[model samples]
Target: MSKWTTANIPDQTGRTAVITGANTGLGYETAAALAARGAHVVLAVRNLEKGKAAADLIVGRSPGASVALQELDLTSLASVRSAAGQLRSEYDSIDLLINNAGVMMTPRSTTKDGFELQFGTNHLGHFALTNLLLDRVLAAPGSRIVTVSSTGHRFVRGIRFHDLQWEQQYNRVRAYGQSKLANLMFTYELQRRLHNTQTIAAAAHPGGSKTELTRNLPRPVAALSSLLEPLFQDADMGALPSLRAATDPGVLGGQYFGPDGFGEQRGYPKIVGSTDASHDADAQRRLWAVSEELTSVSSPVI
Candidate 1:
């Protein structure tokens, strides 16, 4: 079979897609591709100004593309709730919920909710948003929930349940790794819960893409990343794994997509494997339980 590309994305006409952090990078590319294919794309962003700008850009590129915006800040559960409520009120069903926004390695900080910034924004934020809007997702036929993880998931051993908040000691890299690992664990657990339903949960990684997500990288790391910039793909190419996972008819629950090149970086999208730790059923469940406790949001499917 030919390698999957944007051309292979099935007709998404009449579908409603909500993509978090759609103002730039892989999310913007994914939103543009889907909107071009006729999906009513909702840009759930933290900044309405940037969101509007992105929407305008998409519409400019694809005349008549249906694009909307919703203000969301993952660091605050209140914002997630507000965004989900507004989305539920406007759309009867959500065909796609792309949990694509995230924070990379940043200095020790807390969210509006007092959790570690990376874990709070990247995992808990999406966790709450997903649960809040799960009903709408389930209402749509053949719907999907796609979370964007990263190759950094392999950098950590597993979820640091003991120091989930990183109050003990802080390490930017490990925290980010835990959050990305949580993303995969959440996807797996969600798929397990949705097994009897039509909606499936899948995940993708951008695989060494040139995007703003690296803005939080420490100066030394950022300098090294700049030195190795030649190996990174552009945002459009970075989005293919996510696009394929969202629209490919062959995709199944619990599957992951990433680049096909060396080190799973900078190439065509293809089905890929995550760390064995990511697939541990017990770990997935534990993370789900802890996420619920932290976010005070329960899975609608359970």
Candidate 2:
């Protein structure tokens, strides 16, 4: 284990990788790295214009990188369904489904479906997309589903079972934490469900990478973060954990990857442990059931 980096990613030629939010930040870096390695990369993004630009940049950098774009807005279930349908119709198999897009702490708001914004976009949206595309992923040999969670998952005590949508008192930090925690729980549960299949589920976190995700932070917090920006790793470095989790031949289902530096914030990727709360089997199952009910999407594997 000589520090897992993009160099460790096995040849991905012929593989189809669909990365949500691939237009920028960690998603952009992840897509660029995979495309450079010869994977047919799909930029699943909300803004088609930015996605095209990202695709162009990838092709420009890699010379012959294969990149495509699909319109997707996680805040809208209809958009998620449409994107998944279009993908299914185009690609017979998907080797990698990276749930990499997310919204961090933001003011209380609701999605088109009337769910809290962060929880809706960061957790429930990806949940539905993963289920809708599970068949295609399963069809591919040695496929993988990698969800990008966060170290922020440790900020919350647990999933707010009673007030998951924050209809009561809305704290942006806790809401974001709940969504991230849901991400890890989802991965662990998905791995359990996919045990009989070749497809496995894993998770990764960028570990305080400087990315556009911080745009939604409050003014004072944003100012403070900006002052501390030098301490944060750039998006390219941040993407290593996800790249490793997605393409490392030795990765196991249910494993998580993150930076190996102080506080797991700025170093190369390595297998890391999540909070004890994240490992609560009952909570994971409950969250899965609730996610299905909320999104109205059934798990394809089950």
lDDT of 1 by residue, 74-149 (tens): 9999999999999999988999999999989999999999999999999999999999999999999999999999
Per-residue lDDT of candidate 2, residues 1-302 (tens digit): 96877887889999999999999999999999999899999999999999999999999999999999999999999999999999999999999999999999999999999999999999999999999999999999899999999999998989999999999999998899999999999999999999999999999999989899998997887888889789999999999999999999999999999999999999999999999999999999999999999999999876
Global Cα lDDT for candidate 1: 0.95
Which whole-number lDDT from 0 to 100 does residue 255 have in model 2?
100
Instruction: Give candidate 1 misplaced runs (Cα > 4 Å).
Output: none
All candidates' TM-scores? Answer: 0.99, 0.98
Per-candidate local distance difference test:
0.95, 0.95
Model 2 has an lDDT value of 0.95
For lDDT, the strongest prediction is: 2
Q: How many backbone clashes does candidate 1 have?
A: 0
